[model samples]
Target: MLSKLFSELKRLPRYAILLAALTALGMTAGLYRLYAGLGATTNMSKVFPWGVWISFDLTTVALSGGAFTLAALVYVFHMHDLHAATRPTVLFGLLGYSSVLVILFFDLGRWDRFWHFIVYPNINSALFEVSWCIAIYSIILIYEFSPVIVERFGNNRLLEWIKKLTIPMVIAGITLSSMHQSSLGTLFIVMSPRLHPLWHSMLLPVFFLLSSIPAGISLIIIGSIVSDMLFGHSLSQRVLEKLGWLMPWFLGLYLALKLGELLVTEELGLLFSSGKYSLLFWLELVVGVIVPMILFSIKSVRWNRWGTLTAAMLVAAGIVLNRFDATWFAILPRQGVTYSPHWLELALLVGVASGVLLVFTILSTYFPVFVETMPTRKPQEAAVEAGRAERAPALSGD
Candidate 1:
């Protein structure tokens, strides 16, 4: 009996176990911080009310922005070839928005008063707009995601109801996502005087919206690759190819807009300056943008599976790096200091992420996130089987 139980446990996914452990640790830290108050726990102070949570947690909402981009492509624009990518992206966005709200609650001084935005109604605040948009978008995402559950249960009536509302919900999601994504950039626009010129621009909203394209695509790519690594099912090569084609075009536009803005604003010299800010700025441009663009523009790189994975990782890192520079690094000159997250704060982030991954794992495991069953064979095994076709057939051969 003990042997059978151990066998069952061994069959469980490793990621699920990791998530469970991290989630437990994160929750323990979070609950302690909740009762202990922010003063006793976090490193955040008067000069820096935001730290890693704001940079990492908040930026993740945009990272999850891939849901809307994919929704618009497959649903609104009717790119049916890409439909397989949509459900997973929507699931990702749901978790992302949920995680951001949870992180925001942790960051609050009066966590209980979070609902005050709805009750008091501040029409003038950028945060107010962002709050409303996220709230509405979260609800829409719930509706959008319901079909997954309904379909899993084979509930035709509920599925039909969800289908009727699907188009409207997708449209609403795209609209509200646009609002909050750009509004995130708008939040920093008001801080222009304090923002490093290399990081600040009047076209902040445009950049945010524009960046969302590659951000969303890169994340989907990374997620697709991860799912392949973890489960062996992935989007078809054509769909990924389509996504790869998009990055170079979008990056080209972004590079032009950013470089032109720097040149026109006379901040071009800063690109060559000596400082931590300049160093980070160049890293963001070079590692994140230029390298990915050059690699992706090469047809051989974007079309090859491994090459595509490398390009996607670069794009994801680049977007995250750019957001980080904008949110924390660029503001250092004004604050006259550096900031880092507290251990508890880092724990909360880990916990939040673990929870998100746990939810995704549970849903994907049970639901039809992919229409195809994931292969059980590893990539090397599959390759070997391909080489010895008559002697061995792999799980992915069909």
Candidate 2:
């Protein structure tokens, strides 16, 4: 098992090397921040306690919802046609959640006191629930992904054991994902009066769950496109076609829900009246939501690779911006402060992102992540092709 894990790590590409270098740099900087204290490297003040780390971590993990979304379609909805997307989605989800944990570790002011959250149970705090869920869910993600490693390593015993554990692991993953995905939004709930009216609502958790579906799906689409381009293979065009159809529906629902919330809250005027916030809001809605929805809604555009990719990218960006707006801008100003990340904080952000990309590149190259079983052609067609080859040989002989 140790050798197999090592080999898997070894299969990581040069980019992963670069990622490791950056992660090391970031880790060193992070250590300095931790030891020297937040005042040395972060722009965080008591009023603006959360900054880039919290925003990025929350957004990334919520977007990682792609794993559960895909699993739901495949295992629950019986959409077996999308099974090809399953492993890759799960892999991305694992990486995303792992990155969140790293950010969480860095974000804690009392780094040494982190163990208190775990060792001393606080079942009361929503944050306590969120943290525990994130930690436990990460483990579930690993176990869920372990079978792929077992299969690749040709470990029949381990594979058998994992297979037995699969159902339980999956159940646990879904439960954890559902809980934390909502709990993340709930984290903002107590901030009530601090959050902008547009975002402040009891339904925030529901919105979070709803938004995550599209975000997750969009990430999968983006991941698929990147994997295809980098690896020199085509994913099932049929699957892409199906996902293309599905994405628009989700995007449409997201838009409708958002608009509905704005209207019901009597915050529709805020879209135009909130000045700078208004511009950010519209950009999130238009560039991220509207454009992607329009592009994806059209079958012609969805079928075109570039168009689909563009839509997916936009949707992913929109999700990120929306989360940022909610956590940083929307909430902070109401509390009479604005937050800006320091250079070191920004560098750490970049480093974590680089590490994620590096890990992905390494894993894709070494794993059977992209390989699929091709359908057999008819015997008659095969014979005809063979006959053509035979005739060419006879012609050369003549």
> What TM-score would every model get versus the actual structure?
0.90, 0.86
lDDT of 1 by residue, 261-377 (tens): 998999899887848888988787788788989988888887798899888888788889888888777875444666777889999998998899888876776677765423436
Query: Which is the leading candidate under TM-score?
Result: 1
- In order, what is each prediction's RMSD in angstroms? 5.3, 8.6
lDDT of 2 by residue, 192-283 (tens): 87777677777777778777888998888877765543444445656777777787788778788888988988889988887878888888
Give the C-alpha miss distance for residue 71 in model 1, angstroms: 0.6
Cα lDDT listed for each candidate: 0.81, 0.77
Report the alpha-carbon TM-score of model 1 versus the true structure: 0.90
Which candidate ranks first by lDDT, i.e. highest?
A: 1
Task: In candidate 2, list every pair of residues with a backbone clash.
Answer: none
Local error of candidate 1 at residue 77 (angstroms): 1.7
**Model 2: residues with Cα > 4 Å off, grouped in runs:** 1-13, 334-336, 373-398
